[model samples]
Target: MAVLVVLLGGASVAARLDDSSSDSAFPGRPDDAASAPLGAPAAGGTASDAYAFIATQKGGSDPVTYDPCAPIHLVVDARTIVDGGMKLLEQALDEVSEASGLQLVVDGLTDDEAPEGDAVTGPDRTWLPVTVTWSDPKASPKLKGDVAGYAGSSSIERDGHRWFVTGTVVLDGPQLKRILDQRGGRAGVRSVMMHELAHLVGLDHVDAAGQLMRPSGDESITTWGAGDRTGLAAVGSGRCIPY
Candidate 1:
């Protein structure tokens, strides 16, 4: 997740009205990339969506906002990695749930088998798919690309009750393999898993250097932030729609 992994207060009355007129672009990368969305918001649009999460804020109970029982499925194959990585992911998920007041139910951990994408047309849709890539630890490169890791989709909007987030978290390559099998490997594993899970729950990088949302250069935020909580509340409340 970016840090403030943002959401789309999707299909508000105004957006639906302008869907035809707006230059629709998909916000995040899609698992079903064959079809470009008609009115999808992109990573750049995340800032705008973050703002929307705020504008649509409706209050909720102190100890309860987003449905605690809502199942947030993890669509990854954790079986391929060391046990430490899997345990770290579980703990990180627990942290996200504790922070957001929402239950992130990881459904079955299936193999990284995504059906061929349909004609990908970016509608306001998110899909969760998982993949695992393997490489030699000794031959693994030292540097990383812009995307330090990979994941499927997490935290999407659809029929009211169905909230799915299935994605990948790199686990098998050389450097990663060594790190996972190393002494006190939990640090690396936890950070990586926690970061990805953050995305699963809807967080985007923040300018605050130390926040989990901020990418590269530095690290901070062992827990969620105000924006994180607000986003969670917005999604959990199902308040994306105008009442």
Candidate 2:
């Protein structure tokens, strides 16, 4: 309802780090201009009294640096019998991963066939991909059952990476399609997943209308600009503490 893919972008965690110098910031979300304040500081210094994770506003001026968790895998427990917009969301996520510099590996594990033991990663130097358990509107009314997704459990200690995102993101294909339709196709879809995945990596909303972290939706500026790249790089690999 209220959104923007959050903000920023970065390098391929899979890339040869030896070649790159540093990534960048401030891609700006589309919706920031029409609503909320920008670059406001947190109330006092207490973390508990801090602002909402995803907010109607943003304050801090200094950009979040890029340091993402590597090998971000995904698990898609989509319906064996796919439905409308389902395939679209999946394809988009993969494309976004490539564009955003995150390694999103999806697994096709059903709720029943879900691993008996290792939920995140197993001892075989492998982990439960992205743990995607699908559901529709009949199951989740808010999403009209059209929503199907999952959250990475907190402290999923598998491999060198930890579970950065600990919540479910119901990226409705209809809402996504409608909002993105204005901007064309691939570009719109990329924006949606890119924003959500950034949240997965621990990015907060930004106030800069020109920054990718903005909350309000904007279609005119479709691609993740330099600022968006900066924000995304910051979220991907870092000292993550998922609450």
Candidate 3:
């Protein structure tokens, strides 16, 4: 939803890797309290009651969107993935597709190895495919603190349409693993994955609490809320491109 949010620069890979090992943890706010995600929707409470939309920009002017006529190809880097991890991601993607009226197909595993504290831990170049990988804070600085995951796409103007040619989803392996290892952690992990996938489909964080796009993780909101479903449907209804 947040077009060109600049989660991380593709070119910053080299530098980030060099200093990744030493990058200090960006702890969540309120040392004594857990940090919640920052997203769209809901005025005063959680996202459950609120819904918001994200806008995409084309040439810094017109709004652009991904083609709804085709399936979104997704490839997973399973090198460090835990057993059944890919299953979870796929299921979550399926849910998103159903809600958005989009199709998602798993293209299988990527030959790319797990990142070694360098880059964004995704495809070497843009327009390759949506790449999903499990990584630590070293590979994703945003994972250092309360952040659970991140997702974004690369866009290209094609046939008078702004197409999201490729995208990336990075999960906090260590943190998520720890949560998964604990009681009721699987639900949390799945919720986080769903939230990130929503981002991939052009949903941005809302200010509400009950919504799935909440910046702060809410395990209870396992399924898509009304607002989330609305945004996803809209994103999937974008103009179709003839690529």
| Model 2 misplacement above 4 A | 1-70, 79-101, 109-128, 132-138, 141-153, 156-167, 177-183, 239-243
Q: lDDT for every model?
A: 0.39, 0.39, 0.59
Give a tens-digit lDDT track for model 1, residues 30-62: 332223112211112122222122112225322
- Best model per TM-score: 3
For each candidate in turn, the TM-score is 0.50, 0.48, 0.70
Q: After the best TM-score superposition of candidate 3, give how far the Cα of residue 129 lies from its true spot, in angstroms.
A: 1.1
Q: Tell me, by lDDT, which candidate is best.
A: 3
Worst-scoring 10-residue span by lDDT in model 1: 5-14
Candidate 3, residues 1-243, lDDT tens digits: the string is 111111221111111222223423211122212122112222231223255444455455322445565567788876557557887887897788777766667879887753343232233332345778887788667767666678766554444455554567887777677667756666667778888888777777776756677667555667777777767766666665542
- Backbone clash total for model 3 is 24
Model 3 / residue 44 / CA error / Å: 26
Which 10 residues in a row give candidate 2 its minimum summed lDDT?
10-19
